[model samples]
Target: MNPYLEIHPEVQQALAAGKPVLALESTIIAHGMPYPQNVQTALEVEAVVREAGAIPATMAILNGKCCVGLSQQQIEHLGQAKEVWKVSLVDMPYVISQQLDGATTVAATMRLAAMAGIRVFVTGEIGGVHRGAQTTMDISADLTEMGQTSVAVVSAGVKSILGIGLTLEYLETKGIPVVTFGQDEFPSFYSRHSGFGSPLRLDSAHDIASLLHTKWQLGLNGAVLVANPIPEPFEVPAPQMEWYITQALHAAAQQHIKGKAVTPFLLKYIAEHSKGESLEANIALIKHNARLGAAVALAYRQF
Candidate 1:
């Protein structure tokens, strides 16, 4: 166990009993959505996980501890607080040492979840190579962490604001398996299709669990990227989403948003400019991922 980690009693029990537990990131609550919606969605996602027969451990940094499994009040505080640091892999030590309120990004959350021995993690979307990474080298630490951590991540695919094709190439270079659930095409967060064929496809949670088990059992370590498409009805068309993403990227550049701040900034910008349609899709996808993550975790437990 990590010296800085504090697992909730329920989560600890689940781990001790070898039950399914899904690790969730706190950045979605604190930095991904606006006020009341953030808190509401966080709780609702947790409910979705429980309904699917897995315990949810929503992780964050609170008062110098890497707190796993937050309370409703704590979730509310994270959603409403104005000063929560958006902690990524590089910021974890500083935030923990300073005793600051911090919301863990995909990278940080995955690392913490691995430390706590949780195997599956759920999130709305993951950060990836920025559109112009060739010059700026602005790749997200999420990719690097996934390359090293043994946790399996279930997301609605890479955020549309990133360079999807390039991100896929990078993942291949890192030896990470990119599997799309029930689809031949890889999804781009807001939409059900990214125009690229999936490198791998699996149709059920049991199948995914089998893959995870085989990979780790054979000493092939590192995370598996499970891309779950947003429900068809909620999907924003790829072309329409690209326009919004372009505008958001311009706005981010104009504001000089860099590093960890860029994602939340771009997400907020798109949500606002799209008249909340994007936000709704974001919420729907996360809840959808929660269910699948739980199902996979449960299946993995059987192995």
Candidate 2:
């Protein structure tokens, strides 16, 4: 009878029990990884969340409504479908009104997660100000959404391809706290160190949850970005990824690629040029982030 969302029975049960539930974005299935592997990684991430004692809710847009948790068949189809729309916060109205199929980006996912009463969201990276944003005047809607939404986003960090320094500054200006887990440095998506100090660091999930609790108790809007670095063995060396990023940026300039097309193109180029290391690191970090996200949700439940 819920017109706004198609809630999976398992997720509904978890909600009824007051158990922790972690929200997952669907873009990673639709636009992030290759077909079979995308589905496989999605399942693996859910398994990790379950192992951490939280329910997983993968969100997508389907049949003119937000789907709070997709079935495995739907997940597989989303992973392989080339026509899946990249649904962001702005895209929700179109997807709903037009009755189109779509996958939720970080901003959209956060909105849907909150609709489902889910407080924690897991993603490989959250978008921010693009490189050369002063000239391009481009910024992701995710940043603004984080400034106003009440959800906790767990990510490795922003993608290395973006201007992380500006992103951090922008989040600070918007009053969104950026917290890194067990480290002084924020992480690059494909590597361990992003070369910038995190504004705050907490050694444990309980500490992070307490901060989130205090923020809400004080009636502050906006989300907290919890940066959990990928394990050392799983990360690519920073200098090595930098070379690939530089080369990809040059190629983008040569081809005059701009706007949203720029990110996918550069990522694809790096994936191929790095002999698929970027994609491998991506999978590893996503799984790592999912585990941390579920842990955060669990701690939040205790609070």
Residues 1-303 of candidate 1 have per-residue lDDT tens digits of: 778999999999999999999999999899888999999999999999999999999999998799999998899999999999999988988999899999999999999899999999999988889899999999999999999999999999999999999999999999999999999999999999999999999999999999999999999889999999999999999999999999998888898998767887888899999999999999999999999999999999889
Name the runs in model 1 displaced over 4 angstroms. Answer: none
Candidate 2 local distance difference test against the native: 0.90
Instruction: Please list all clashing residue pairs in model 1, or write none if there are none.
Output: none
Give lDDT per model, in order: 0.94, 0.90
Model 1: weakest 10-residue lDDT segment is 258-267
Residue pairs with clashing backbones, model 2: none
- Kindly list the per-residue Cα lDDT of model 2 for residues 86-157, writing each as its tens digit: 888888898899998998999999999888888999999999998899998889999999999999999999
**Off by more than 4 A, model 2:** none
Clashes of each: 0, 0
